[model samples]
Target chain A: MKSLFFRTISVTFFLASFSGAALVDDHIHGGDSHLPRPVVVEYSDVESLASGNDDVRLWCESWRFAGEANNLGPWTTVPVECVSYVKTYMTGKRYAFDLEMVSREASRFARSIQMRTDGMDAWVFDIDETLLSNLPYYAEHKYGLEIFNHGLFDKWVEKAVAPPIESSLKLYEEILGYGFKVFLLTGRSEAHRSITVDNLNRAGFRDWERLILRSLDDRKKSATIYKSEKRDELVGEGYRLHGNSGDQWSDLVGSSTSNRSFKLPNSMYYIP
Target chain B: MKSLFFRTISVTFFLASFSGAALVDDHIHGGDSHLPRPVVVEYSDVESLASGNDDVRLWCESWRFAGEANNLGPWTTVPVECVSYVKTYMTGKRYAFDLEMVSREASRFARSIQMRTDGMDAWVFDIDETLLSNLPYYAEHKYGLEIFNHGLFDKWVEKAVAPPIESSLKLYEEILGYGFKVFLLTGRSEAHRSITVDNLNRAGFRDWERLILRSLDDRKKSATIYKSEKRDELVGEGYRLHGNSGDQWSDLVGSSTSNRSFKLPNSMYYIP
Candidate 1:
C-alpha cells in the first residue's frame, strides 16, 4: 500500500509539473509543446482542498505545483513563470479561482460605497465592461487589429447582444435600492442610444434618467474628456458623486472632483 | 331639449359677463374687495366640463341646483373668490398636475442635451420640487410655514416614504438611458445627503450621479452666487451644459450657459 501510494503521488507530481511547464511555454512562445498534458483542474477542486489537511495535495492544487517528492527539496523550487501560467490558466476557466477572489473584492468595494454618508451620495458606472460584457464581440471581430472598423462595430452594437455581468447588475440594483441614482456613462457613440436602451431593458437593468454616450459627430475628443464633462454637468445639477465603478482605469478618473473608484478585473483585454 | 340648450348657453354667457365684471372690480379695487367671496369656479368642475360636453350640467353642478333655468341667467359668475378658493382646494391636485407636466418637459430638455454633439454634453436639474415631491409633506406637516424645519424634513426624507411624480421618474429614467450623467443640485444643506438619497431611492429616480448641496460649513452666499459657482465648477470640468430644468427661475437663471430652460409651473406655489 505504501509503495502504491508513493507511485500515485509521484505520477501526480510528474503530470502537474509537466502541465505547468507546458502552459508557461504556450503563453510565452505561442506554441503548444507536444507533451502529454493533464486535464485542467476545476477551481472547485482547489476550494475543497483548502479545507483539507494534505500538504502535498494542497501545493499540487495551488496556483503553483512543486516537483516530485525527490525533486521537492529546497533547491527544486517551482519557476515563477510556471506559477503565473497556472494562475492565468485558472483565471481563464469559467469557474476561475481568481474570478472568485476578484468578485469578493468587488463586493467589498460595493459595500464600502454603500456605507459612505459624507454628503456625497451618488455612484457613476461605466457601461461597457463595468455593466455590460462586450468582450466576446470585440474578440470575435478582432477589433484591436490596428484599424478599428467602426461601421462593423456599430452594426454589432445595433444587435444589442451584450450580457450584463451578474455581480455588476446586482450591485447596480442594490445601489438603486439605496437611493443612489445610477448614471450610465458610456464611451459608446450617441448613435447607439436606441440599441443601448433596448439592451439595458432586455438585460433587466433599471431605467436611468441619463445615459451619456459619446458624440457621433465630434470624434476629436477622447472618452476621458467626454466622461469628465458629463461628471461636471452632473455637479452643476447638484449631485454629490461618492463613487465610480469601471473595468477600465480611464472610466473612473473624474475631471472636476476626486471620486472613490472600484476597479473591475479586465487584464485579459483593453479597449481604446 | 332645445330649451334646455338655450338655457345652458344663456347661463354660460351670464357667467362670462359676471366674471368679466368681477375682473373689472378686481382691477378697480386692486384685489381688496370688502366682501370676502370665493374666487373662480372650482377647477375640478371646470376640469369635468373640459372633459365632457355637459355645459348646463356643469353649471347646475357648480350651483348645486337643477331645472332652475331662471336662476341661471345672471349666474353671479362664481366669484373670483370662489375660483381662488377652488384653486386653494385644488392646490394639492394642481401641484401634482404641474409635477407631471414639468417632469415630461424636463425629459424633453434632457433629450435636447443628448442631441447636442458639437460640444461637451451636460444637463442641470433642480432639486427639491424638481426631483422630489416635498410639497405635500411640507404642507401637511407645517401649513403656511415660512421656515423649513431641517430636522423634521430630514426625518421625512430618511423614511423615504414619498411617492415621486410618475412623469419625473419616467424622465429621470429616460435621461439616464440617454447616457447623460445626472447631477442633482439642491439648495438643501449638505447634511441632507442621506435623506436626499433615501428620498430619491424611495421615489425611484435613476442616474443621479452628483448631488451638490449647499455646504453648511461655508458662509451663506446669495442664491445666484451659489448657483453660479456650481456652474463654474461644471465648466471648469469641461462640461458645456445643454439645458436646465427647475421650479424656481433662480435655479435656471444662475446656469447662464444653459442652452434652454424648462420652467416648472409655480405661479401659484413658490417655495420661499
Candidate 2:
C-alpha cells in the first residue's frame, strides 16, 4: 500500500515537473499563529522530493489562475490543499503587485476615455477587495479554507477596520479626478449600511455619488442577477457605466456591464 | 548613461524578485527558426543578472496570467517583450497542462448535469484553440508578436491541417458520450465551411449537430456581439446551453451565456 501511494505521488511529480511545477521548500508554518504565513518554495530545485507542499503548491497556483480567469465557476471555498498557498499569496507582495497591475491598467483606460460634461458619466467599484482589504479578517479565519459564514463575517464588518486596498484607492481617486462620478456597489446587505458607510470613510474612501447594497428582497437572488438589475437601474437613471472594477466576475458580468471592466485578483472566495 | 540603465534594470529586478519573479537560464533559442522556441529560466537564481530574457520571461508570465484572467482588454497581439514567452508557453507542457486542467474540470461538470432525453440540450465549443490548434501556424509566424494578417492566416486555414487540441478532443468525446448534442460555434468565416469540416473530421471530431460560422452579414460585428446573437438564436430554437467552452471571453460572455462556461487559455491573440 505504501509503495502504491509512493508510485502515485511519483507519477504526479513527473507530470507536474515538466510544466515547471516542482519546488524545494523549508516547511515554515507561521510561529505562534493558527494560520500559516506565506511559504516560499524554490522552483529551480526540481530534483527535490515532491512528497510535501511542493506538489500541492503547484496545483494551488494553477487552481488560483483558474479562479481568477473565471474558469472555475461556483466554488464555495479554497481547495483544502491550497489553503496555505492562498494564505501565502494573499499575504505576499505578489497579491499587491497583481492588484496594482490591474489598477494601473484601469487608470490608463480611464484616462483615455473622453468623458462628457454631464454628471451622468459614472464608474462602478465593488466594495470588498476592490476598495477595502479583508486580508486581516481572512488571515484570522482559515484564509478561505473554512466555509464562509456571514454571521462571523458580519461581526468583522461591524468592526469596520478593513484597510484600503492602496492601489484601488488610488484608482478611485484617479477616476474621481477624471470627472466621472464614483458609485460604490456591494453585495453586502443593507442591514450593514451604517457600518459599511463608516468602514468606507474610515478606510480613506470619501466620495460623491451613492453606495448601493442589497436590500432584504435582494438576498435570495444570485450576485450576478442582483448586481445586473442594480446596474440596469443605474442606466435607467441616465448613468453611463464607463468603467467597472471588481474582484469577482459576478460583480462585472451580466446585463448593463460597463464599457470597460477590470477584474482584480481574489482566489480566497468566489461569488457566483 | 549605461549605469543609469543598469540601475533601472536593478530596481525592476528588486521589485519583481520580492514577488518571486526572478530567474536564471542557459539562453537557449530555437535553431534556424523564425519563431524562437521556449526558454527555460531558473526562478531560484535571483542574484543572476536581470538584463536579458530573465526579466522579460518573468513579466511575460504575469502578462499571460493577466491575459487569461481577461484583465488585459482588446489586445491585437502578444506584447513584443513576451513573444518568446508566448512561444515557450505554447510549445511547453505548461500550456498543455493548463488546457488539461480546464478540460478535466469541464468534463466533471458535464458528468454532473442530468441531461434531458430531448435533443435540445447542447454544448457550445469554439473552434480555434478550443477544438483545434493553430499552434503550427503560430509557431511559424511571429508567435503573435507581428500584427495579425487575416490574408496570411486564411491561406493557412485553407490547407485544413490544423490538429485537434488533444485534451479538448477528449472532452468533446466524453460529453458527446453523455448524450449532449455538440455545437461547433466559431468566429471562423462561412467561407471556410468545407475545409473546417474536413479538418475537424481529420482531427477526430465527428457527428457534431451544427457547425455555425460567421456569415458575410456577421463579419463586421465584434465577436462578442456575433456570438451572443448566435447563442440567442440557439436559445430561441429551444436548445438549452448547458456547457460552453471557448478560448476567448467573447465566445462565452454577453447575452445568453450558458449554465456553465469554461475558458481555455489562448495568449496568442485576441479577436476583439
Candidate 3:
C-alpha cells in the first residue's frame, strides 16, 4: 500500500510537472496579457529601499563597487541583505542571476562533503520547510498569522495537505534507510506539538529517533540562539553532525562538528 | 562604524529589556475589556483532535498501553499515519509537560558524556526555531499564506526583528571564540539559502566556518531513512560532534559521537 501510494503520488507529480512547464512557458512568453507583469527591481531601486539605514546603504554601496579596481574601502561590509534581495527576486530564475554564484559556491561546498564521506553517517534536519513543504500552508495562511488561530493551523497540519518536494523527500528517506539517524530540529513553538508530529507522520517521514521543538515555558533563549546552544549541548553529549539542512543559514552556523551544508531553492516571493 | 553600531544595538537591547518586559505585560496580558480574549486550547482538546485521525488514534492507544498487562494485539494493524501522529504528538509534549524528567534524562546523558570525553570537543545544532525565531514570522504571517508575501517577508528579514535569546547567543559566541568550528544542521529546505543567511547576519550571528542546509537537488534518499547520514558525513570530514542541542529526539537519534544532547523545551508545538 505504501509503495502504491508513493507510486501514485510520483505519477501525479510527474504529470503535474508537464502542466507546470506549460504554465511557465505561457507566462514567460506573455500569454497572460491582461495580468500585470512582475517588474524587476533595479540596483537603484534597491539602494532607494536602503536609503534610511546607513548600514544598509553602506552595504549596498559595497556590493555595487565589489571587485572594482578603484574602490577605496575593502568589501568587508557584507551586504547580506542585498544578497538576500537578489536571491529572493531571482528564485526560479536562479540560473539567470548573480545569486546563482552564491548557490554554486554553496553547492560546491556540499559536493566537497559528498566527495569526502565514509562510514555510517548522520544528518540533522529542521522540520517546517526543510523536509516537508509547509509553504502551501504558509502561502494559504501567510507566515503563520493563522497558526495561532485556535486549532485552525493544527487542522491544516493534521490534514497533512502540504505537498512534499518529491526529490528532496526521496533524498531524506534514502539517507535514513542507509543506517543513519535522522534528527529533526524545529522551532514550531511548544503550542503545536501534537499537530506537528501528526503532520510529519502523515507526510510519511519515518525513523526519526528524536523530534525537538521549542518549550512553551522555558524562557532561556531565542529560537536561533537556542539552536546554536543546542549544537554545543549536542557536542557535549557526543553526537557528530555530519551535515545540516535547513531553509535558514542560522541552522548551519554555530557548531564545531558539521563542515558541509546543502541548501535548497525557496525563492517564491516569501522571505522565510 | 559597524563596531559602533553593534555597541549601540547591544546597549539599546539591554535597556529595552526592562521596557520590553513592561510592554509585553501591558500588551500580551493586557486587554481586560476592549481587546478580544485569546482562545486557549486545552490538552484534552488537542487529544480529541489527534483522535480524529486513525493513525494518531492507534499510536496513542499503543503509547498509553505501552507497559500494561494486556497487549493490544501487537498493535501492528495500526496505520503508519496513526503511529506517526501519535509519535509526533507525544514527543512534542514530552518536553514541556515532562521537562523535569526529560531534563533529568538529559543531565544523566550529559554526565555520561562528560565521563566519555577523551579530550576531543565539538558541537552540533538543529536549525529552524533553534537558531532563528521563525515563529513570530510564522505567527505574524499566519503560516506563510499572504504574509509570506515576498516583499514583506524580505523587509522583515532585513530588519532581523527576531530578537536573540541574549544568554544563548552569548554562549554560542563564547564557544566560537573558544576555537570551536560551530556546525549547524536543520531540516529546513535547502531552498532558503539567501534569506537564511540574511536573517543570521541581521541577528548578528557570525563567524561560523561552515553552514549546511538540506539539498533540494540531491537525490540521495528519504529523510525518514537516512537518519545518521549527516553525522557520518561530519565524522568523515574530520570534525567530531561533541555536544548536540535540538527540540526533537530525531536530531540526536543516531549521534553516537555526541558527548551530550541538550533537548530544548519544545512542548507547545511540533513541526514535521
Which candidate number would show the highest lDDT if scored against the true structure? Answer: 2
TM of each candidate vs. truth: 0.33, 0.79, 0.31
In model 2 chain B, the worst 10-residue window by lDDT is B24-33
TM-score (chain A only) for the predictions, listed in order: 0.58, 0.81, 0.52
lDDT of 1 by residue, A1-272 (tens): 11110111111222222311232121111122334334332323111222323433233332121110001111112222233333333234321222222333334344555445543466788887667766556455432221234456567678887776655676678777666767888877666788899888887797565788776442444455667788898888878776677655446543744245555544322332
Report iRMS values in order.
38.8, 9.5, 27.1
Backbone clashes per model, in order? 37, 1, 139
Looking at the true structure's interface, with contacts defined as alpha carbon pairs within 8 Å between chains A and B, what fraction does model 3 recover? 0.00
Q: Tell me the lDDT of model 2 at B73.
A: 51
Residue-level lDDT for A227 in candidate 3: 67
lDDT tens digits, residues A1-272, model 2?
Answer: 11111111111321111111012110110011112222222333223323566656656666777778776645555666677889887776457557756775687678878888888999999998889888788888889776455567778888998888877877899899999999888888778889989999997898859999887777656677878999999999999999999998888888899988899998887666
Superposed Cα deviation of residue A234, candidate 1 (Å)? 37
lDDT of 2 at A243: 91
Cα error, candidate 1, residue B32 (Å): 31
Task: List model 2 lDDT by residue over B1-272, tens digit each.
Answer: 11111111111321111111012110011011122232222233223323566655655666677778777655545666677788877776457557766776688678878889987889999999898888888888888776555567788898998888877888899989999999998878778899999999998999899999888777666678888999999999999999999998888888899988999988887655
Docking class of 1: incorrect
What are the per-model DockQ values?
A: 0.01, 0.17, 0.01
The better candidate by DockQ, 1 or 3, is 3
Interface residue Cα RMSD of candidate 2 after superposition: 9.5
